[model samples]
Target: MQEFAFELALCAHLERPDRVVGRQLGAAVHGRRVADVCLVEPGPEFDRRAAVTPHTIPPLAIESDAGPGTARPVAEAFDCHPDRARAVAERAVELGFFEREREGASTAVRQTVRYPEQWFDSLVGIENKPDLDRPGDLRDQLRIDASLGLFDEVVLATETYVTGAHLNRLPDAVGVWRFDPETGEREVVREPEPLATDGPGIELLDREPGRAEVRPVTAAEKRRQRRRIAERAYGKGWRTYELPDCERCAPSDAEPADLADARLPWCAWTDGLVRPVADCGPTCPGYEPVDGGDSDGDAEGVPPSEGPEAVRARRSAWEPDPAGVDRRQAGLDRFL
Candidate 1:
């Protein structure tokens, strides 16, 4: 199967229950390393109360020029969308997320939410490899992930059957999983070793044969790293892409007969499951005018609306708490 198809199927399986999963996340500690999939499970501290609920907070307002050194009032920031921003600014004031103060005889409001720090628990990283026959530089990459110890666990998932030779090439700390993309089923062949998130971790600065350089990580440093990663995962949340809002190919329009196996998106034009990334715009050959537009009224090729409100509507697909507010304070205006 294509790697992308495998990844999507694996993602669907990982998100089968209440688990929140992210794709293509950057988890490098010293260098730029991106993980194929990231799974986050909310801890006891994950405040469901902080979840964005209608009328629970005010509409958000922000200065148009949010660049550094641009001092502006929070209220002035909401000038563009006065009605919505005003209500959000008010709620922000009430919830202590925004602090209203006087500066040089003028009132100013600033955000105070520490974010992901107050909302996430643990993060797990997964690397997808559909064909182990072509394992290119997999060793070094897994080695780096294992040494960083940023993730609680690192897993290598592939469709290839497990072999002793494959295990020998990989670090034992990295777990192995046999996955079947067609069925969206996965079995853990090797359990991963838990990484120490609170203690010093080996940082591979330079490694060349006998000459190797590493740095010591303090618990405080680990804490900072964890917060940074959690904050990123909270913001990126999985489901970076969206399905085309095409009525003809929409799940709602699929025939009852085709609804089996979850009916995957069926296209009357193509007479089969539409390509996952197939273009379904008015310009496409398969485009057929439907009586009604997309349920959301947004046309094909148009990405879903972004912002706290949109996220709250699709939170489960985006973050651990699909019911919660967007972790990014900038997108928290949904409550307003």
Candidate 2:
């Protein structure tokens, strides 16, 4: 619960108009390592990428042979099985990344626009350990992140006071930040050194007894994984939680003064930020169910709050909707 609050507060603090921030994203290539938060700094072609779609353009479609010039049969363009290829192509078309055409009996697809290679500048992976004293798997997680070099930089954010011993235990490449979730004040304890993103790196897979399993990730694979991360982040912003249908839920009052407008799930009864799924419902002592039929009654369920999509569109670089490119007419010549 503390970690949840800390993560949300940190995300609110990091969010701005210049970059995009997402939470609980998969950061590893071969292994299953979920980053606490991912900060995506915009590259030179960010505007072009954002104009393509508000949602993620299917990575498979981006990597496939489909181009803007010619419409290729889905089966021919995508290397995957016919069904999977068609499904991915369909999703791409839905997202305005691909334009579909009837090629005789088969379906052909082409990119609405070329995939922007330099859409995102750098990815900063942050691991939130609000309480460093209870540092379960903190060392191992940081080690995997630093060794893999998938992110441009990795940092550990904590509320715990740093000591020489704590710094000594961490990898020199990993940066440290002391963040107070209550006040939204962050102090950088150590600056992170950039990782070798251009070259191959090691990925710690598993460990048992004295032996540890590892894999060597190639540069090409890392590039694909990085793109996947960026797309996922762009599609899934940090405001992933929904407010519970409870009158006591006060999102505006839950966050710090800086983040008062963040619209997090804060229970007035608990007087703290809460995970609506876990901490809410009738089971909770303070859960006052919103009376739907209360036209004049004092009972109020969840207040009419601005949606997360609106908040994200207002606060971040992510576009809620874009005038996407639709090249379906270009493929019409094939019918002629």
On a 0 to 1 TM-score scale, where does candidate 2 land against the true structure? 0.93
Estimate, for each residue in 1-336, the C-alpha lDDT of model 1 and write its tens digit. 666756755665665334456678767666667888888776655554235322223323322222123334655666556566656666665654455555576555655443324455677888888899988767777887788888889999999998999999998899999988655567989999998776777766666778977676666666666655654555555545554556566533333321212223445566444444655667777675555534222223333233323532343433223353332355434532
Alpha carbon lDDT of each predicted model: 0.60, 0.87
- Candidate 2 lDDT by residue in tens digits, 1-336: 499988998998999999999999999889999999999999999999999888878889999999987789999999999999989999998888998888799998888888899999999999999888899999999999999999999999999999989999999999999998888889999999999998999999998899999999999999999999999999998988877888877666655754556677777788888888988899998888876732111213333445778778878999998877756655457554
Question: By TM-score, who's the top model here?
Answer: 2
Indicate the worst ten consecutive residues by lDDT in candidate 2.
293-302
- Model 2 residue 134 CA deviation (Å) reads 1.3
Alpha-carbon lDDT of model 1: 0.60
Error of model 2, residue 290, in angstroms: 2.1
TM-score of each: 0.64, 0.93
Candidate 1 lowest-lDDT run of ten:
59-68
Q: Give the runs in model 2 whose Cα sits over 4 Å from its true position.
A: 292-304, 329-336
